[model samples]
Target: MDNNYLIIRIDEQQNIELHYFWPSSMKIKYNYPTCITIHFDNLSSCFSLVSLCYCFNILSTSHKLYIGVEVFKAYLSVKFSQSYIQE
Candidate 1:
């Protein structure tokens, strides 16, 4: 509810999942979609602008583009599976 954090998890298959966390309440909620899957010949395509922004804190989730940023101020945490790098 106040000061949330954005966490992105990318699996070996390039499956991305997003969730919001509130340390105060110790809760985590998934975004609209539980998971986002991208299929392409090259795995590099998974690091597109949109996904990069989501991973790098360049984009806001809760505000839904209303303020063009996080209203309560948020932090970003990105997790990648070991296979992600080996790919």
Candidate 2:
């Protein structure tokens, strides 16, 4: 496990949002809340965050968290039909 990595909360909808990334290079660690958009200071940091999350989720232990789809829907609570932009 990387000490310098971001945790992206996986929710339902089979959607993998580019939630955050890990930047071990920083003096202080960064944290992003679920459902909130993250703005990183560097370009590489952003890429590193996504790459790690994708790989980790794929290779990590076979837990119910990853296997359960209903859990994600309950956690994220995002409707597919809903748009981010306001009318």
Candidate 3:
């Protein structure tokens, strides 16, 4: 039987949003507890590394969390100017 899942997203404003996903044939397994997945969307834009660490510290009690950062090539190109000026 499929397992029910919860998706939690932390917004730019540090608001907690919850989403529930349950399949039609899903059944709650007492032996296997429901799993929760957290997605920190636009976290870098909202919180600095230090703040993110602090946030994680508070959340560490309930579950173990891992963070992954994804950067776009376009963003990198824009951040690095094409014009070369030697000082």
Candidate 4:
């Protein structure tokens, strides 16, 4: 069976959007003050935050969080790719 997942994205304006594509498709959009405060019931879903600086093409004032997420995503991609290659 394929793993079903959801993606939560927070825009620069603090708008939140939930994307799900598997078994069914749905999108829920709203506004939230902080991206970190958002919660998800699914333990297998992926969460991401998009700061305004990056969206507006401005130099990000902070890199710690963004870099961390990028690294994690890259790690997952590599792991998944390797698993498929081995099969």
Choose the strongest candidate by lDDT: 1
lDDT (C-alpha, whole model) for all candidates: 0.37, 0.35, 0.33, 0.34
Off by over 4 Å in 3: 26-87
What total of clashing residue pairs does each candidate reach?
Answer: 0, 2, 0, 0
TM-score of each candidate structure, all chains considered together? 0.29, 0.23, 0.26, 0.24
- How are the candidates ranked when ordered by lDDT, highest leading? 1, 2, 4, 3
Worst 10 residues of 4 by lDDT: 34-43
lDDT-best of 1 and 4: 1
Cα lDDT tens digits for candidate 2, 1-87: 343322443334434343334344645444442232223223344345534554345433433233233323323334343322211
What is the C-alpha lDDT profile of model 3 across 7-48, one tens digit per residue? 444335433333434444645453333232223344344324
**What is candidate 1's TM-score against the reference?**
0.29
- Choose 1 or 4, whichever is better by TM-score: 1
Lowest-sum lDDT 10-residue window in model 1: 71-80
Instruction: Give the per-residue Cα lDDT of candidate 2 at 52.
Output: 52
